[model samples]
Target: MTLRRLHSLQQWLKEKDVAYAFIQGKANLFYLTGFRCEPHERLVSLLVFQDNEPCLIAPNMETSLICQSGWNYPIIGYSDSEDPWRLISTHLSSLEIVGSNLAVEKELLSVARAEQIKALSPELALLNCEDTIMKLRLIKNDKEIAILKEAAKLADFGVEVGVHALNTGRTEMEILAMIEYELKRKGIREMSFGTLVLSGEQSANPHGKPKMKSIEKGELVLFDLGVVLEGYCSDITRTVAFGNISTEQEKIYETVLTAQEATLSLCRKGTVLGDLDRKARSIITDAGYGAYFPHRIGHGLGVEVHELPSLNENNQDQLQVGMTFTIEPGIYVPKVGGVRIEDDVLITEDGYECLTHYPKELLVVKP
Candidate 1:
């Protein structure tokens, strides 16, 4: 199952004129090799040549696991004495005859490692392979969407538990703790990213972490979180007012909600990504809060929390059917508070479908 996908990837790389490609980042390694290990100990990598399908370079201890998986590629084990980076030169000697193009993950490779590769392969031309991998991953197949759907359900379950746990006396830190505990109890994987539980004035900060302050009335609480299921990820953010009477707070909430709903309604196949972002931004800007709506509308959500085909102003990609992503529009006012309504959408030939069905309207839970 994994080999077929990898072989297709290598073929695409060849078509892109990428002859010698390296995969060092754990995310890319896991994509190529179905096996995953901690980030520090293993330091596993794969070197895929032009004609060859793919080959993994890893520590000797992990050979048994790789072999047991019955993968299609050869598992070449390296020792501590033989440097992994230098192993590139050993593999590229074949490419020398072919005079191949070498590429690596731009975001993952460190400056030092990149310098080494540049020096070692002075003969071969180097290019960015990250885009190649990202484009392939943008459109999910049936199996991939099924995994994400399950993950979304788990995230919804966690959010339900969090809403019930948001008592008047509980602290933001306490609710964050409960979320972690519930996810762990259900055998859910750790967060692909950090969990956020911000309350009151703290909600003004987009990525605020949980604090020790107790939950209070007349304040908005923002819970930005997700859960991983079967190695796939789900992300959702909901804002609720514990207790409120101010017209301004309600206005802000309603305006942001309207903007998000407008975007969701406009999503469909053949829509330009930048145009999609404009739909949401235009609504919020017309409400006389243009400056408050900062940041891109949303981003692609996938195996790694962020992926390609971003729903931003600079995206040149067109929205194709079978692509899965998020539509989150927010209004932030420093020191006052903020509201963000996000939902994951899957593109279809007919239009776009919202995978995240947990209430688009704001859920106001009393404190």
Candidate 2:
């Protein structure tokens, strides 16, 4: 039931003098409630109160499923032609929430939705609760860690599939298709993020989409992919060579590898989160590829691929036990190619554990 999470949230609401909270983010809703779904144009939400039973407001179509999901709370369902806010207003008034401060996820709630909620109660003061929710979701429980470990294994298998499907003349799209097809055959329902397969000069674009261009020998191929397994997510990136590679390519690959490994070594509890990015940046800058490494070192990974505690400069948060995130450092050179080595890691009491055990050493696919 995620009761611990609810307790923490209720405590936060009490501290802020908020009557209740509207958790609108789909991912956050699933984290607190066991059920998950997307209601496109319909209103699906979880209204949590500081001192009362939480309510799950969903479409009428999902009412039976919500009841069967073992949610022993109030389930408020509305028809397509009805106004959800009206029912919500009834519930809020019953709880004496009118003219009180209510917390909402400002980062996710749309402006139109906020206006609707304001219309529901003219005197309601809406406060942003994204920071409070981020704190609640920062630490991973034992079950979450276990699910993430399994997801990481699937991610490694995905890389292996992509590496085996590589050929001298295969298009990037072809390889991407083969990788996804094989993973689906093994029960991977979805990828955490878009599957990126870039070859040769195309790899220079860190977030480039796969193209139909044929892969050639003696060039670098970057595979950045992840998978969703058991509601958890895994993300990884590995750059490999086709046939024979040049010394410059080897240098770039090695430099990124060194930077990634060095930063990973400092991923222990109590270490400043931003220092990891600075440490990796130092290595890349020393190798004269600082500008090429554009993005941050990595981000937190869990129910959603990207979560709290981003590993980048300017964030002063310290790593804590049970926190999981990625460590990806890349070197992208225009007209040449890019090299990115990423691994999911978990912070422990003593040190950090690397979850994704895919080989980071340069892999060469034969023609």
Candidate 3:
């Protein structure tokens, strides 16, 4: 139940002289506590003290699920009519957490909630522990890597569903619906991100929204999607030819494929993170599509699709074994179509393993 992670946090608190740590991010909360829930407007958190048992503050309705998830710690559930922050203050006082140093997730905690915590302990020194938590979560454990591998298979399955659903004159939304429906039938509760199905010229927009526009013949169809399976996530993007295609279209697709492959080949232990982005960017730039390929190479993937160690040209982090991320390179033209090939990868001791095994070769579907 991630009790080891809890101990690690407590050790960090003791070293830093922090009294307590307030974990508010849903992803971080699930990572440390083994409990997953989205309270929305309601308050859901895990309070960890330096020298005491951790406490879980959650909605009364979620108590059973929290226990079922293997969390056997002290839980203080509050009804919607009750004040959660006030209860937290009382708990803090009882544990001698009042008027002491406190650490919190600066990125995840909202302004109003921070204000409420301050009201409870105005003299309390508030510190940001986001980086410390991120450092703990950066390198995936063996179990997390295994779950990510399964998730990668589901992500590849998602691409297969989307590709099979592709047809001439089919609207982008229709294909999106077909893909999502197929995933739901397979028991995938959610996608890592919104399903992206862009066809023809619409695909050139890179981040374009799926519309009712029909996918015409000889157009490029980009499928950027992933599925959340067993709490981990997998993201993949594959651009394919619809019916007949032109030489220019095929060249763009090939260039992007080359960039992805070259960047992936460099995903091993001790590799500087920025070099990966540079390798892909250099290939795209040498292909005369530098301006078209605008976005960073990729991002770290795990409980959240985007996480630590963003693969950008300026990042200085080094890739280590057990760290997982994506390597995606694309070329998007205005009037023309776009081509993006992405794969989830795991940095290994010697080389690397491609988690998402979906075919990146140009596939021309029958219309």
Candidate 4:
């Protein structure tokens, strides 16, 4: 699969008349080479030439791991005392790549690194290839879809653990820790993002941090989290009542749920992506909480939690089969709290499949 992905990129490079591509994004590296690593402050990159063989560069300590990851190409490992940029320049020169046009991930490359790449040769013309790569990754193959389905199942388990851990006196962080600990015991080493356990008024903050604030009766507790499995990711959000809640709170929850479901029902091949967002937004707006909704309806989910084809009010893109994304509609009313229902969705030829199916009915946990 990695070789096929690499071939696609190489074909793109050939079509554009580009000589080489310097891929530095961690996610992109994983997608193209089957090697995943947190390079940290070190430089880890894939140098792909249009006509020559590609190579991987990383810290000396990671070379073995890269090989174990099924990378069969030349790997240039650099020690801490060595200058990797200088070594990269020498390798490029050996390949007779001077004066050639190079493609790069403009969004991910840092200014200092870009300057170093520029210093390699005055005649090297750098072009942005981020869009092309994103377009390639937009549609998931059958293998990727199968992996994502497994990841989404794990995400459903995560939400289950969170719901079971809910209690009147338990702090938000306590539930958060329990959920992560359980996932870790299940062999999940990384979370797609920080697990959120926002309760009471704190939930009003769309991106609030989990706190030591105790869960109380008649409050809503929100769990927004995702797990990373085999380089793919799954995201889910569920807001449930801790105890018997106010009718106003119930209304807020139902409104968000209705909007989410309406938008999800609109998902299918050839459907206007932006209209989906509008469907949810209109529902929330009609419910008199449009001002409470701030962020986009959802984002593409795969190698990264957030990727291409953002589902926003203004986007005019159309959904295609094999495209996967999240459909999360939220309403965060200040002081009254918030409610969000999120599910990972995949567009199918006939319709769409809701990957994360942990139930959307409002669950009122007994105190």
Highest lDDT, which number? 4
TM-score of each: 0.92, 0.97, 0.98, 0.98
Candidate 3, position 230, lDDT: 74
Runs of candidate 1 exceeding 4 Å displacement: 64-70, 79-82, 86-97
Give lDDT tens digits, candidate 1, residues 186-282: 9975786888888888887788778898988887888888876766678888888887636777888999999888887778887889987898889
Instruction: For model 1, name the residue pairs that clash.
Output: none
- Computed on alpha carbons, the lDDT of every model, listed in order, comes to 0.78, 0.89, 0.89, 0.91
lDDT of 4 by residue, 1-367 (tens): 9888889988888888788898999999999999998999999999987778899989999999999999999998999999999898888779855326778899988899898777866576899988988988899999999999998998999999999998878999999999999999999999999999999999999899999999999999999999999999999999999999999999999999999988988999998889988999999999999999998999999999999779998889899999999999999988999998999999999999999999889999998
lDDT preference between candidates 1 and 2, better one: 2
Distance (Å) between predicted and true CA of 121, model 2? 2.2
In model 4, which range of ten residues has the least summed lDDT?
Answer: 93-102
**Cα deviation of 341 in candidate 3 (Å)?**
0.3
Using TM-score, give the best candidate's number. 4
